[model samples]
Target: MKFKHYNQQQTVLLPYSFDDLIPEQHPVRVVDYVVESINIQPLLKAYSKEGNPGYHPKMLLKVMLYAYMTNVYSSRKIELALRENINFMWLTSMTIVDHNTINRFRSNKLKDSFKEIFKQVVLMLASEGLITLKQIYTDGTKIEAQAGRYTFVWGKSIKTNKAKMLTQLEDLWNYAQSIDNDDNPDPEPTQFKEINKEVIEQTVAKIDAKLSGNEKASSKSKAKLRYIKNNFVANLEKYEQQEAILAERNSYSKTDTEATFMRMKEDHMRNGQLKPAYNTQISTENQIIVHYTIHQNPTDTKTLKPHLENFEKTFGKETLQQLKEITADAGYGSEENYDYLQEKELTAYVKYNTFDKEQDKNYQKKNKPFSKENLYYNQEEDYYVCPMGQKMHKTHQSKRTTEAGHTQSLSHYQAKNCESCPLRGQCFKAKGNRSIERNHNLERHKQRTRELLLSETGIQKRKQRTADVEPVFAQLKHNNGFRRFSLKGLEKVELEFGLMALGHNLRKKIAA
Candidate 1:
């Protein structure tokens, strides 16, 4: 018989142990080596002085990072891999860490250490000249939180409902007063500047104190008080609690109150449902994330300032001095951001809304008369000449406020005579006056940014930006399949994200 005999039971001794099974270039090796390089004594301080020994933090950190590199996110899945996968066994040295312990360490022990560990990894890359830190391509993406979409609490909804409840509370208060044979039964409704649970509780206490002082109760008065206590008081109190939850957040998910509702890219239905998610901001260089931050803001406009502040704090002012330029998309193109970049003396090639239109000659010609740039402006006189030869003289300078609370001076121009203009229909949509308000400050900043966007360096930056940061997000979301977060609060999520970034950076080092 030419066929070799094969047995079900097989036992053999190997020349080398599991340590030799993994190659030197393997990512797990990098993970282990980098994790070992980090000083985890601060993390170990949290443990009890005397107890049964637990898994070393280095072993656990290596396991978690290796799991992330392999696209295994769940703690349970990592646990299974540690027990089953040969690579995991080689990484952990055959140590079995339960899923709960892994989850605990991620949520608790590594919360503060994630930042330090991630910083160490980035600094290592910088020292190796792998990360230039000269050019930071910043961008943000929405990642779903571990909260239900339907469980949402909106600030507007709470305010509106609270107003109605206050009206009901007043009506109930009046009913109780009327039962006491008081002519002032219909008291004026309470005008509250802010309504919350504490206010409602205080109001309830006042009513109770009045009832308690005059203990001799009539049947009718008793029934009215009961109704107020059971219905009106209860509702106001409930509304107040809801208001407490709505503090500082525009909208929060009921299941995960810390998570704000944001539209996600992974929503296959594209229904534009506001799911509980976070706007994760990342600054990447050489296809590796150098810095990252988690924000509650859905728009990317407001996140840049604080993100960089954190960067400065983490890497110091000296580190920012080493940066030659910064590039971001149109979402981060606000006047404040431009001013910030200018103040920092870092060359910014950030794109604004008008940047693309300025480059398109056809668009310029098509919208010339309507567009502010093409209109004939008498800067000395502060007047604009329209397409129909109508002169709009600058009337006043007004301060315009933004959602972020930064006020800018806007020069308002009004047409001298628009009552009988031939192009009134095209020029003005209103009945009386045609007014145009321009933020000259913002416009000037935009003009400066426009020049930067069209320069040779700007053109080079635009092309480099297209290739730098986005691929890091792609690697995290598509390659690693990290679309939704399993952790709950912002701090915990930040920790996990930092770990993910660490894993990704280490993987990049290994690949390099």
Candidate 2:
């Protein structure tokens, strides 16, 4: 057979819209369909009545979301795709959108509506039966922020520095008064609160005028005055802000002050150097991120309550009240969490401190009766019998308080005759006697937790929670290369995570 000849410069007239350029079954079609279905009123609310015409929110949201789905997070890259990529051109209708506009829409216009929009998508998934909505699995990972690794500030460090600076301020105040021959008592602590950047500047100016005119002030006094003026007074606002963050947070980043300095596992040097990051918590079902929130807390313990609470609130009480079970790792094991789930009457497979050790027989045997698991307690008499046949009598009841001032009941128990017991070497480490403090309510709740954790259905759910949630994070970070956040501050950080989750969900929807 003869081959067809091709012309070097052949041009044919063909009529086809951008829609025809992208197939009907393409992923862009799914994005377009979903974008068309959702209510864009929230996005439109950001625009004024009329000035110059701008890109529609639906087109912008579609492009932004599609960009995230394809792992193109940068605005400039998205802008280039909008112009160069035919699929993006088809989805965005070939509209030219600048990178600044794209960034603004993501970091500004879409910030407030991130949760609402994400909730809509999740609710849609729930309605479509993609997510069960009956069970929720929450896990947190530290995502580095768009701040320098060295720009870290701990709240404790600020308080220590502040105290030293305050003492120096007092010393300088005394020296200044002595130099002026005014022997009035230095300003009180209450008066110190009134001293601001302006006050310090005025005081420094007065001292400088006196020193220049008379030159009798000591070099030490002049240096101290200059030091406080240059450093303390200049950065008073920043110091106050840092102290405020430190008062509430353990550690904060200097560049992005709201970002807490957390040790991320993806350290290149393997030394666990602190990076400014946000602790991002996400609840997943069927490998789709259903809900997510940013927390400053470095650990996952405190995030559970608020995460679940926000989950319920986002979907509404009636919609989420049916959710009766939650599964999480041992990182979220705490009495406060267990009690909260109990109070809400929701089933929780939340582990406690010793939950993992209790699972292993060898570990259990190593710390039996002393482990609280091996202690045999009499329900009627309310006393525990040690493995050595010694009765641990309840000595007293006391209230133990947490940092948040929340109180819990603790029963102090003393093992009778531990001083002369044969197993004292193995059991009792204390000199005189062995004492145990138990939170009676917490222990009872833990017993119930342990039973559920060991049950057939519970075991399956536990496995499913790990299987469902972990890969979502792994894919988000490793596959998509989303190890670090491209934004700064909590709000912007939240918005970026929201978009990523939404994109990931949309991709899942497409695959389905």
Candidate 3:
């Protein structure tokens, strides 16, 4: 094992410099081209004039887009990279911007601007034959919000807790005073060492003021105060327990009051806990995201029309008209939604509950055909025919008022007729007559459904919706680490969601 040692003198030389390492037309370089193509100078000019002195909006946007593309969401980390990482250096034009500035830009003016920029990119891709505007898939996925579910305090609960806290304080003060009197041998000494009456009175007055304000506070405002208090308490507890957990090998758990629990699927207690999030909706055509929105609404049914309307505004009238089919899962299914699609003359494959296997399986086997779709309607008779070929005559037509104070003309069918019919067991179990209530828009819904079922391409496109949309959410949660939002309120949550969608679209584009 004899070896010869010599003074280090040998050196290796590289053929190319760091600048030459990256291709001149790399996707990173295309950042500038994309920005220029979108024509964001006016936005930059506006922001610059409004107290943002030297920083260019394009530079900030490019940095953000690059961050999203790479899945580096934290503003501080992005700021650190600019001063260190070569790729970020080049992307941000070698300018080092602070994390606060980066964050402010993303959270403030950049949200709307990025939304418009996303649309422009989608349009650009469409023009380049990279995307087709004909068929689109729409879906929503819940991302955890910045606030915890526990932080959502009901007004009733807050009132109860405030009263309890006040009582506790009063009892503690009384006990402390009793202890002082018991220990005091002289009355003069006890009087001098008494608790500050002014402080107690002020605290009581403050509590009373809070209670009075609660009566005037909106439900939303009350929730916000509770959220802040919960966060404050949780943070305090976290710090107090930090030291005790430091030495233990298995007990280093911390609670984030501002973190809400959400999930991709409704599985109670899994691998790692997820937090409160928004339901992000995205509309895609030919695998490119054309329209996107983020909502605090936990459900998907309410988001369909708004997102579609936003899509129309983003792409212009001609491009919107080119959208032949809108596909969504059972979550987007509603009679109103179907009517809306029909009014727009847009084919929709919005699956109603009957289409979902879990829901269908829960129904009695014989009753499955009793679904609205399976009930044969005779256009000539203006009535429904049972599966057993028994006609359900319109017994009565009367105007009915809804809880919302809207009147509708409802035609009721004979329940007695259904009782003796062979399809009675399948159709209705009610003691009274089984009725079919038709809305004024019933025809519109039927037309929409007819169009959707008849179009071969539309049907095929609808089948592809789950494949196209669900995977986006899967990647966002499992791969991209975007299970919950880092911000609060619906608006900020929405902005965060837009960023996530932008990230997804950019990744898809790059991969394609």
Candidate 4:
């Protein structure tokens, strides 16, 4: 056997660049290419001309995105990569950026401008014929926030505590009135609107003044009054502030005030515990994330409008004009969403909650023979034929207002008689005749969706949807291990995810 001549101290005559050391088809090259192609004036504007020039935002962006693509999310690890990894060195041209600088650039500098950067990348991808922007497959997933799971503030808890305080205040006020001999009595039932520190202080002072030196008032009650005077005001103010932060959300994480507690599917314990997470909604075209939005609400139905609105705001309404259709799972199938899709003049291949069950013949025939779905409706007469062949006439109409403020008109249909009926035991669970509510407009929309979804084109789109969009999440979360956010606040987390989304697009491009 022969061994090749190798020397530890051998010096080369030629000096080659870091580019020569990297492979031509490396993903790092693609990252550099796509990032360099985008207009980074938004990122450049973050810097001031007065001070000494910092590490180029362009370089930092490339490095951060590449790091995320490779599953190195920590800033310190990225800094280490810049020093140790050959590909990273080549990408940054041997410029080693410190972790603090990297974190600052990501957390502060990229916060406002990341959306533009992401849009530019998507546009670049569009130019390359990767994404059509014709039809978008939308889906939402809950990603855990970079906060302690137990550190949560529930709006319900706040309201309950506040209610207790109100009760205590009322008792104290009534006691004060009963004991006081003054002719000028305090107003009965003080109306507390938007409880604040000032309101509590004023109420406590009045009660304390009336109760002071009164023999009828017990010492324990006096101590409680003092306690209320000392703590109730501060506690009420805190609850008020928390409710303000909560807005429409039921709960928020104390560590990350913007992060709402949501039930995530990635439950390691299998107990279905609610964790502090953000509802991440993304619209994809040809497996590339064209647009994304972070929402505090956990429900996907409420997020569609804002997500599409942001998509238009980022890319322009002209971009939405280019969209021919939008497809999503049952989570996004709401009357509000359907109406929005209709208003946008875009075709919806969305599925409602009962779509799958409606497809099952056994469900219709055996499982729910007496259910509203199995009943036959007469469009002309506005009545439904029940399982017992009874005529369920349209009795009245009602309207339901959704969280998004969209009013849904529904017609109530009730069976004329269920008493002494043979199927009464099976059908009539309530005290009176069996009734059902139907949203005509929503039913029409569902019928249209059913037609579209059952069509040949709809079948292809439906099949392609899971294959196209799901792998993006599977790759990012399961394969690449980006299940949780690294940043605390919403804006910073959005920037972080934007970087990851850009990385995903670039990686997909490289794979192609």
Alpha-carbon deviation at 398 in model 3, angstroms: 5.7
C-alpha RMSD for every candidate: 3.9, 4.0, 12.4, 2.6
List lDDT for all candidates, in order: 0.80, 0.81, 0.63, 0.88
- List model 1 lDDT by residue over 1-512, tens digit each: 58887876766675558877788777777777887887777677767769798788778888888887778889999889989998899877778888999998888888866777777778889888898888799999999999887897888887787777666555545544554444544343345455556555665565555455454545665566566567755666666677787666689888888899987878867887778998999999998899999988888999999999999988889988998789998999898888888889988888887687667888877755766666788878889988888888989888878887777788888887888888778765788878788877778788888888888888988999889988898999998899989899889888878878878888889778
Candidate 3: residue 108 lDDT (0-100): 82
Model 4: C-alpha RMSD to truth? 2.6
Residue-wise C-alpha lDDT for candidate 2, range 227-283, written one tens digit per residue: 876798656777787777776678877788888888889997899788888999998
Q: Write the residue-wise lDDT of candidate 3 on 1-512 in tens digits.
A: 87897667755595435467668756666665677678785456346445437677888888887787677888999999899877788766578999998888888877556666777788777877777888788887766555544433222433354445444445433433343323542222122122233433443344333434444434653454454344534543443444343331211112333222344463346654444555688887655667787654455777787788877877777887888878888787766577678778787777765454533455546445786545777667877876666677777788876432335566666433555666666666766567776653545565556566547865676668767876777787788887666767656666777776766776666667
Highest-TM-score candidate: 4
Q: Residue 367 in model 4: shift from native, Å?
A: 6.3
Candidate 1 lDDT score relative to the true structure: 0.80
The runs of at least 3 residues in candidate 2 whose Cα sits more than 4 Å from the true structure, single-residue gaps closed, are 1-9, 166-238, 370-373, 415-417
TM-score of each predicted structure versus truth: 0.87, 0.87, 0.68, 0.92
Instruction: Please identify model 4 stretches exceeding 4 Å from their true place.
Output: 1-6, 177-199, 367-369, 386-392, 415-423, 431-434
Clashes of 3: 11
In angstroms, the error of model 1 at 184 is 7.3
